[model samples]
Target: MKTLIVEDSATLCAIYSQYLDGSGLEVTSVETLADAKAALVDWHPHLVLLDIELPDGNGLDLLNETVNLSSPPAVVVMTGHGEAHAEQAIQLGAADFLTKPFDASRLRVTLLNAAEKLTLSQQVETLAVKREYLGPLMGSSSAMQSVYETVESLAGTLATAFIMGESGTGKELAARAIHQLSARAPGPFIVVDCASLATDQLERALFGTDGEVAQGLVAQAAEGTLFLDEVCSLGFASQATLLRLIQHGTYRPVGSAAEATADVRIIASTNRDPLFEMREGRLREDLYYRLHVVPLRMPAMRERSDDILMLAKDFLDRIAHEEEKDAHNLSDPGAQALRGYSWPGNVRQLENTMRQLLLTSTSTEIDESAIHQVISVNEISVGNAMRSRPSQLAESAMEPSTIQPLWMTEKKTIEEAIAACDGSINRAAQYLEVAPSTIYRKLQSWKAQNLNV
Candidate 1:
């Protein structure tokens, strides 16, 4: 480790320097506060041995300045014998005190312990910052509180987690919370999309190649977390590979004989039921068992009726802040419309709608007209509307489309698929297991019906 010795006495500075150097620590000695500050900013030492009195200024003043440091090195104050000086050093967050003429062994032990504590404290602060940045999952409902509790409980453990939720319900966010809370918080948190990559590409990404040696998400998340989204879509071969990794914590690169051990915790997320997938032969039962250690289910927006308005306002504020525009206050009618709407697209869809409204609305206050425009343009059904908690909704009838019924069955099916995919058109089509062309054809046909203004 590196050490800095700051003392006004030139003899003591030199003596401590020689002792620290002999102990295999790189040491820099400075006699004045100015030189000490310069060395601290430039050298970034692991520990400091600071004298209480300085020729230019009291070392306590220097200690006060060091606390502003982004990553402050530990300070061990050296005082001449006054109780006042020792008390001041302790108040200023000095790691420990060394009386003048202290033994070399005592100084070394104190420095070593302080350095270790400093490292641990820094790690804890980093994790706290990460959790704060991620924000709470944004719900006031009991179900959401329960979900939050589960996430908090799992965050410190190494157990594999399986998250089951509709699309746009924040599965990845929950996985991140778990990783940040876990013992491996310092390591990387890697994400893998099982549905996005082709089977061959997926295998290559997960298992890696011989010549190039790609660090598969699992390998990259060594001593951390690997989050698998849309895991139910993984092909049998990939599923088997994943199962092996979960079971044995060992995997070989695509063509290598040497097996590497993975210390990663697996967090798999899927909109589909893993049990259903397994029963249908789409997912292996053994793999399902391996991944389903702790199951966390996120409630749908409809289920958390009380939190609808809060979520809406939160989204509106976020959008307005991002755009650098005045946030629009929702009038009672507008608030009612939001609460009444089924929100088939869930939180993500609500966020996007708020952004669109903020962009389109000319007035500072969002009124019923603006809400109706969003609903009409988006073609949300009235039957699915006005169903949330009374605290959220303003009771009023939305005009039904006067247009003749046109493939109502197909529209219902599309809506179902969209909801199943968490509002992803592509994934919705995939769930229908139909060609993209077919979805496009049906959408075009529905638009041609020219539903009322």
Candidate 2:
């Protein structure tokens, strides 16, 4: 670890440097805030021993700046003002504060604690970058990395986590990950599909009726996890009962007078916007707050397009093994097609597409034609479903007179490349000699403008 000591007194600096010697930290000493700022940029220390008072300025100012760095150093504020500015220093993000007359032992212990925290934080970051799979969840994108970190952090605690995402975005999988990684891994993981049951049925299923021989889902999930999928679909009555259970950790079975203690961890999920659902009275506001202790949002497939092919290949390999068929490799064009489409149905849809290809395709290598055959069928099904519903088709229809020539030409070129590569922005960007982010930005702009790109 790199350590920066910001103190004006050369004698004190020498003492502190000697104290930290052989402590495995590369130390750098600066006397003023100006020099400290320069050292912060060039040296990029992992830990900082900051003095509250400096020759040029207050060390709290430097501490504030250091904490705002992209990968900020742990700042231990050292001051001679005793408790006068201790509160202010801490408020500015000081890792530890030491009074002027502190001994070497006090300073070392504080630095060690701060250093330990920094080590753990760096390890979590490293794991996020390298880990491609967390239980059933698999992705290497920045979005998925964040999800992985959150899941890992939540696994050690008994906090209730509310996962919100589009349907088939693997909310259940995330719940399972939390359960499997938690201390309750040895116990059962019970799932309740709130959308599948009626209000009465849901209540009966969750909390057993009087004199029932079989235990309810909550009881079945004792000392484990109870995953409530599509929780927004739960009726108001059921939501109230759930809120009571979460708040009191006790629930009464229908027609029963006694309360049963709940030993299970609650993990709820919904495909709808929870806030919107709450406002519309579809979900209880109180219930939402109680269960929203740790909100985990699953990234949609479109948001993590970079992981499309990786997920596709994993599905293909796993499906082949299950069916006792020869493993199929995704051809470049096939991969391109997989990446291009907006996966509204998310991972579940992707997995289904792979299964369809394996069942129908006889070739060892799955190419663009095979992929398109499966995708087109899916698109047709989706189109049929959309057509059945009332839609603003006329209002959304574009007119030729509204088109801009230059924008149309650019859109056409990009569209052609995307079509040729089976809808991959990365491939199209390569053909256009532009960054993928550049194309993504333009596509977002075009979508916002309703240009139909």
Candidate 3:
């Protein structure tokens, strides 16, 4: 530990220097308060062995400054005067107070104890700063940067936001990023997957049971964020309950008599079109509007194509570090194949592919062949096939065996593209080989038809 002895008496300072030096501690001695202040400003010592009675000023003056300063070092005050001064020093944030003419044995033990406390304090503050932010959402691409900024801007506001993206698009991670940046970051971040739970199970999970005073999903997420994934799959009754909670901020347990208030920021996600669900009346229109206050449409991997290799490298490095092995760099052909192939599963698929390569490959450099083995076109197709809901395939296949007019089919294709890209009109137009204005016109026409429907 680095120790600073602020004693005006030259003899006493020399004695302190000799004793602390022999004890294997780096010691610096200053005879006046001015030199002490200079040392404190320049080299922040781990422990300040301050003498209260300095030549120019009392050490008590520096105590207030030390305690009040940001990143203050610990102080261990010493006095050659009365007990009153010792008590005063302890009151002003002194970790320990020692009287003059103290034995070296006691001073050594006290300084050691003070050093431990200081080390632990620094460690705790570092961890606190780290926990204040969630995991790195690694992407510097304009598309990803926009997503980051949107989450940051909306984090402080207590409004519901709906995030729509395909599976493996990191919806939950996005939700967590929002919460980490939010004012209620210290509160619970509860995630409820509507698609994973049965109707009865979802009901019990969201709105706790009768005998137990169930803290519904909203209640459990009070003053925090509630992430409801695959919200379109929520049963009709649960949808109604969730709608009531969002609208009125009030809900009751499934079988309870007591009504509870919900003060939560609901962030809902779905792979399917919430509008389609609303159109079919499977998802209530009112609930849709309530949760869609600030709809954040997460772009699919194809839309954010620039970030493909960057994300792949990031995941690869993470896996390497986790396995305690040197990082495997991607070859040119490997990178080319990564960017060329469509990541239908988005970021999640890329992460899995990186892990698979790390597990299977023995070489330090990952080549295109290794990548192809892990991320085949057929493998991706199979993944997409598995992700497709029965209704989604049925809707796609049952879209009139009799072909519609070319213009009408083209319009429908653009609409589907827009939905697939999470409402990016520019991407939709690019996918359709048309101008953005044309996409807007088609969207307007679709809206008109929706009104009629």
Candidate 4:
């Protein structure tokens, strides 16, 4: 680990240097806060051994600044005024505090413990990046990897989780993964679809009706997880009741004068943006805050194009087995087509498309033509249905008669992404789900063609 010592005392610096000698720390010494800040930028140390009294300013000021870094170094504050500044240093996120006149053995032990913590944190992060699947969700793209890590972390706690994603993006699957990995894994996992129930019925469905002998989902999910699917769709009254349940862990059944204790862990999900719903007064702000403890956003399929073929093959294998069909592989062109299309319906739609292909195509290898046929049929069906809706008539009126060339569409999309990222090719590539090299090559090709890039 890289260690930065911010002690202004020359005698103490030499002594501390001797103490950490052969301790496997790449150490650098600075006498002032300004020099320490410069070393932080240039050397990027993993840990900082800071002294409270520097020649220029209080080292606590520097501690506060380090707290705001993107990846702040672990700080060990050393001082003579331990009683006065120890709490303040810790509050500013110091890993450990040491008083002057302390033994070298004490300093070494504290630093070693802090170093071990930093190493474990880095290992967890690296493991999260390498993970490709979490329960039913499968994707190796950075976006999905992040989701996997969050879900895994949430599993280790009882904090309420709020999952947000478009329809068919496997929001429920993510919730299931958390429950399965949690301590409540052996308990019942109940799903309550707030969107499907009537506003009046939702309260009773969740908290039970006093007159009825049957308990509601909250009771059914006792000692387990209650997944509130499309939670934003609940009525204001239901939202208020749910909020009460979350706050007090107690709920009153409809027509009941007594309250019942709930042992359920709430995992709420919504297809709509919770903030937007709050602003529009559809979702209560207080209720939103109560349930937004551990938020997880499942990325749309188009955002993780890197995992398209892998997911396609997995879906195909599972679906074919279920349907008693022969195993089939996607041709190279078919895989390319699958990756190119924007899946508005996300993973659910992709699985459906694969099923359709398996049932209709007789060939062992699904080719580009077959894939296109299935996708085109789906698009036509969606277009026809959309055209029938009165709300879409205005949008249909603006449709162009001729479709733009694929290259022109690609150029517009790539350029817009680059502009959105402030001309950062790497950021644009991430947003576009393509490699930076791909963007560079495309820009070069467009330039070579004398096309406006």
Q: Rate the local accuracy (lDDT) of all candidates.
A: 0.80, 0.86, 0.80, 0.87
Model 3: clashing residue pairs? 206-216, 206-217, 208-214
Error of 4 at 386 (Å): 1.2
| RMSD vs true structure, all candidates | 17.0, 18.9, 15.8, 20.0
- Model 4 earns a TM-score of 0.61
Off by over 4 Å in 4: 1-129, 211-214, 391-453
- Model 1, which residues run further than 4 Å from truth? 1-136, 380-453
**lDDT by residue for model 3 (308-415), tens:** 887888888989999888889899998998999888878988898889898888998999999898877558779799877577547778556665666677666776
What lDDT tens digits, residue by residue, belong to model 2 across residues 1-453? 899998999998999999988778888899989999999899899999988778788888888798789999999988777686888888888877888888878888999899999899889887656678999889989889899989998898999999989988899999999999999999999999888888688778988877871478988988899998888887766677788888999888888888888898999999899887664445666787898899999999999998999999999899999999998998898889999989889999999999999988989799999888888988999899988886564566867686567878888888899999998988886666554656676677789999973
Model 2 TM-score is 0.61
Model 1: residue 451 alpha-carbon error in angstroms: 47
Q: By the TM-score metric, which is better: model 1 or model 2?
A: 2
Q: What lDDT does model 1 reach?
A: 0.80
**Model 4 lDDT at residue 25:** 90
Q: Can you tell me which runs of candidate 3 are displaced by over 4 Å? A: 1-135, 214-216, 377-453
| Candidate 1 local Cα displacement, residue 277, angstroms | 1.4
Clashing pairs in 4: none
lDDT of 3 at 108: 87
Q: For residues 50-161, write the lDDT of model 1, one tens digit per residue.
A: 9978899988887898888988889999999677898889898898888877777887788878878988998988644422123347776777778877888788678889
Candidate 1 vs 4: which has more TM-score? 4
Candidate 4 has an lDDT of 0.87
